[model samples]
Target: MRKTLCDTLGIEHPIVGFTPSEHVAAAISRAGGLGVLGCVRFNDPDELDGVLDWMDANTDGKPYGVDVVMPAKVPTEGAAVDLEQLIPPEHREFVRRTLDELGVPELPEGEQKQDGVLGWLHSVARSHVDVALRHPVRLIANALGSPPVDVIERAHGHGLLVAALAGKAEHAVRHVDKGVDIVVAQGHEAGGHTGEIATMVLVPEIVDAVGDRVPVLAAGGIGSGRQVAAALALGASGAWMGSYWLTTTEYQQIPGNAATQQALLAAGSSDTVRTRIYTGKPARLLKTRWTDAWSAPGAPEPLPMPLQNVLVSEAHQRITRSADPTVVSMPVGQVVGRMNKVRPVADVMADLLAELDETIVKLSDLR
Candidate 1:
């Protein structure tokens, strides 16, 4: 459906897809929606640059954005090696023992491991911002709270719109006050990091609070076209979708992702739990044995943000390399129950639009 958000971003649809794959991003843009590439995986500027280059070449002159986890709070200074030393021995032992008990094997040989630097750090995220600004990115979204004033000003100076995800009504107000062009009110049913409020309650609250100043995008448990229509009804100018793209064909085609896709397919809505086991932030993850182990008696408390992230970085590498679905930690939303099969991005969008039209017709008929 066409909305002010589409006109503001110069896109044909008011759908904004947040994904980590450049392929998925490009495909969404090519399908008339804006694709926001999640840059948390790219700790290296050069690697991020390469992905941006690919997106630029493949987007066919459509608009796209970049998302970075530039949290409002983080350690001011510390090397990865120094941060690694801060993780307690018991926490490390638990991760090691849990994987062992799950029978998850290690990598075969010569597979590259994820660097433990943890891109959520302020410095690394800023570096990503630097790289993104050099490209033709139309928008820059922050995964955490309102971006710093300077970052907002910087993006504005470059003639790019800035957006941020807020889980609370007050957070949306704060984001707009800080000059964010868009505020994504992501509820608890969302994938990854989330808040306590559900989408149904949070979206309208945020819209009522700041809809006059800026557009609000509805996120959390939004997968179907009906949900998109519902978001528009709640006063959101668009739907900011993340989890919907996880099972897309382009995502399943990524190397070392077969297990992830299978796990997501096998999971139901109740199969997920909100825990800080992965990123030290309360993110919704598939309730696997690895996550359950963290909740058992005598388990060490999870370290905050960067610390917990560093502690499990290596263990996550081993688990992924092993390709064991039982121990894999996949972040997804309750709407995951709707993600039953793999489809192409274009097909997903088309189905969503069809559903949206049908929903609107049904609502209109109710009168």
Candidate 2:
């Protein structure tokens, strides 16, 4: 309650709910926490505008943030990609053959009309950032790495806070030097694209590395109030959470689609692996038939972001909509193991805050 983050963000609770679903975003903010809408899933700025407009209408004046996938390190812009270029014929053939053998047919166009290309690269994400800032988004967070200098400058120009995730101490320094308002020490256990350091080790290292230049939000494998308290103890201002929200009632996921996501966390750590089957980036996902097929010794390696991502987007989208347990594999982290049940988003936030209060009280009562 007393942390600078809560004060700075003007929220009743320090809990930050990260979800891409606009309804989930509004629900979390209405529940007294900040809701962050993940924008990497959007194909273009227009799609982002639609979501932001809906969020603006639903959030009842509560503040929320937007997340973009601006990787700090990327191949030269436009050097390789002509977004207009379709997937390679060979790769496209492979997907079609696999689907045919599996009897998965393309849905009738009567399904939702898809927006433009996916936004997982620096160039496309900048456009997303522009759309997000033009709206009332209170914060801008970069999911991949340090926020770009121009991104940070633009966020500050619009009077918004900017945060970036780092998987190492060195990345934390890069974020600080670029004027990031918050540094999320994201461990390898986080969902989606993550670097290779464990959160327990990375959080303290990054906090120390930054040396109070910016606040740190400890992430990766953090789900419970005890974990949040630990992050604060590790010198972070708070915890930045993702996986914990994936199984909530408001998830865009179909009801039964959560099993695999849940199992990734419940099973051994080996249950998960960094593969690009879903997004083409080295995102940490549960080892599913989908991922295993892509990573098998003989299979072609997953492509880079956006390219690899679009390859599987149709399947991921259709399955999530179908809510068919047999055909779906949701993206999640090792923390999904802790996401044991489907609960209300508000209830989840309340439990976290109550647990945090209990943690603080218990610590004070000691001795």
Candidate 3:
């Protein structure tokens, strides 16, 4: 727990919990660890403000962070073609039918929902950044890649630390070049959008590539203290985690979104198909019937971001409303196999720190 992460973050434990729930955020920060709030699901700025404000009041000013999904590769930013123009009407129809087939009913009457018109593209991402910067957050983490240069500059200007995820050394190098404070070397075993590199290989590679330039935190397939030990042994300052926190007592699990169902659907979603159903990026997901149907040889090709996200957003909404975890997929990594039990947030933190200490002591004995 005395690593650079703990020292830099001024926490007694380096256990960073990633969850969208503000309750978990406050709990983790209260327990002396970084509680990173995920913002991809929230398209509203006011909702984010309320959540962060509540967390700030509850955590007694203990440091916490928020993560946003701003992919480095937007469909048509650097290219000539427009992403929206590229989407086909048949693809849209297919998505509508997919939702209909799933039986996700329309929202009840008078359910006022605020949705951004441009979707999660660059402009909306920047707006979310503005909303986040207004709150009392210690870190600004970009989940997909290097945050926009302007965003990073703005965070640094406000004295906030900026971090980004990397699947390779060159990606880490780009982040460092862009003045990213931390590089999370994500591997294939990670849930959501990930690269092909494995954690064991990518961590050291990033460390060497970064040198003394910036700190590197290992990600992907890191669910326990042993995995954190492996990351530190490979020269990372700490471990950035995601999948491990999904099954905690604080998470909003649907009826069957348990360990058994995760394993049962593991062969389908966990088999590692990088599809664009979620965010229009090469994200890893459980190879479910939906993803398989979209990825099948004769099936329609996935649409680009924003548009693709819009296509499946209705489907996800219906699935979650129905609480059917079998056909409705949750983004998770291979670490799902290990998250068989649910414990309190503080209890989970204690177990991780204790296990890390034991692992470190045993390794010292070995040396």
Residues forming the 10-long window of minimal summed lDDT in candidate 3: 75-84
Q: How would you encode candidate 2's per-residue C-alpha lDDT over 106-157 as one tens digit per residue?
A: 7677886343245666877889888988899888998877777877998999
Worst 10 residues of 2 by lDDT: 75-84
How well does each candidate superpose onto the true structure, as a TM-score? Answer: 0.97, 0.88, 0.88
Q: Rank all candidate structures by their lDDT, best first, as comma-separated numbers.
A: 1, 2, 3
TM-score result, candidate 2: 0.88
Kindly report which residue pairs in candidate 1 clash with one another.
none
Clashes of each: 0, 2, 3
lDDT of 2 at 12: 75
lDDT of 1 by residue, 215-284 (tens): 8899998999999999999888899999889899989757877888888888888988999887888999
Model 3 local distance difference test score = 0.74
State the TM-score for model 3.
0.88
For each of the candidates, the C-alpha root-mean-square deviation to the true structure, in angstroms, is 1.3, 3.2, 3.7
